[model samples]
Target: MNRIGIPLRVGLVLVSLIWLVPYAWMVVTSVKTLPEIVAAPTAPLPAGLELGAYREVFESMPVARYFWNTTLVALGIAALQIALAVPAGYALAKLEFKGRALAFGLVLATLLVPAQVRFVPVFTLLADVGLTNTLSALILPFGVSALGTFLVRQALLSLPDSILEAARIDGASELRIVYSILPPLLVPTLVSLFLFSFVFHWNDYFWPLVMTTDDSVRTLPLGVALLREQGTGVRWHIVMAGNVLLSAPVLALFALAQKQLLNAVAASTS
Candidate 1:
């Protein structure tokens, strides 16, 4: 080990705790009695755990519907984004076409444009087609993801040109080369992008807030917001419970795909 290893390990441990403590607190708060929470908000340990808050969350809201909405939109965004980004990225990375650099530059330029900046134009366009308060409104605007495209492009760029040339020499069409040859190699990067898009759109509050008007189409974040508003006073326990329920999917996704994400990122950058 290096001389700095001990200190570096200590620093990382502290950083991890600093990041995780809040989430741990949220889980604790979710189980605590309201009175216990009020008495000592900063207490790391709950005096006793109860399922009351979680029970109330389910009783008061359509938790299943919220989950369905969130899952539908998240999956829709991820699938459509991959469908579009894979081809766009492949073209930009491999195929010779006029203005390809300019096109790729424009795609990168989108990363700088905040979602807030695009909301009005996108909303108006969707509204013109009468799609507001619908899942389409949520999924359509995200059909192409700039960051996803960039990741896929970088992943493709990292592939050995000789392998692609060999495939071409085997009389494979470009589409065949892309569809058949590239996918196995691109799996890690695709998984990373899928998880990134899913988590992002799942937790997204602002866009859903703007697009949806009713519980029928609202996601968990919006449903959680509604829970807070429906109560005359805030219930921290219930709020935290709702948050825990809301965050479960994202946590599971990360836990399952973390290694793939890390490996793909490392390979892309290397």
Candidate 2:
């Protein structure tokens, strides 16, 4: 340990606690009865733990189906984004073509514009195509992500040209070089992209809200919101329980992949 390490560790601990407090509160609130929550909403310890909210969460909604639905949509979007993003990114990064700069500029420009602004047009498109209220509606609009393209392009930009040149000298086609050489080199970056897409689409509320009218293709976030909208009025405990369920997969993914995510992000930026 160094002289400043103690304070640094303390700072990190404080930050971690700051980040964790809300989640801890959610857990406490989820397990408490409404009366108990009302009595001492800020209490660190509940008088008694009730697993009832978890039960209600499952019973009041098709949470398991929503889980499956969300998982499928998120994975589908991530997969399609990767498939499109890589080639687009590689083209932007390496290939010299007409309007390349303009194309790249348009992609980066989308990052500045909020998705909400385009929702009306996209929703209308899906509606006209009769794809609304379907999983494809959830997946298609997000399948080609500008952020994913940007990140993969940034990662590709960080690569040395010699690697591609050597492959080219060995009589490999550009497609072959990209397919064979790029994938392994960009695996961590791709994983980072996958993590980003999965977390973002999994937690997205607006698109699901606008696209689907029924529970048949609803995702977890939509399911949670629906739990709050029932005629009986808001059930905070159940809502908190749904929230915990909503956050679990994201938390688990972060716990498992934080190392790779950080390393890949750092590499791309560097």
Residue lDDT tens for model 2, 39-71: 876788878889899998898899889999999
lDDT scores in order = 0.87, 0.87
- What is candidate 2's TM-score against the reference? 0.86
- Roughly what TM-score does model 1 have, to 2 decimal places? 0.86
Clashing pairs in 2: none
lDDT of 1: 0.87
List TM-scores for all candidates, in order.
0.86, 0.86
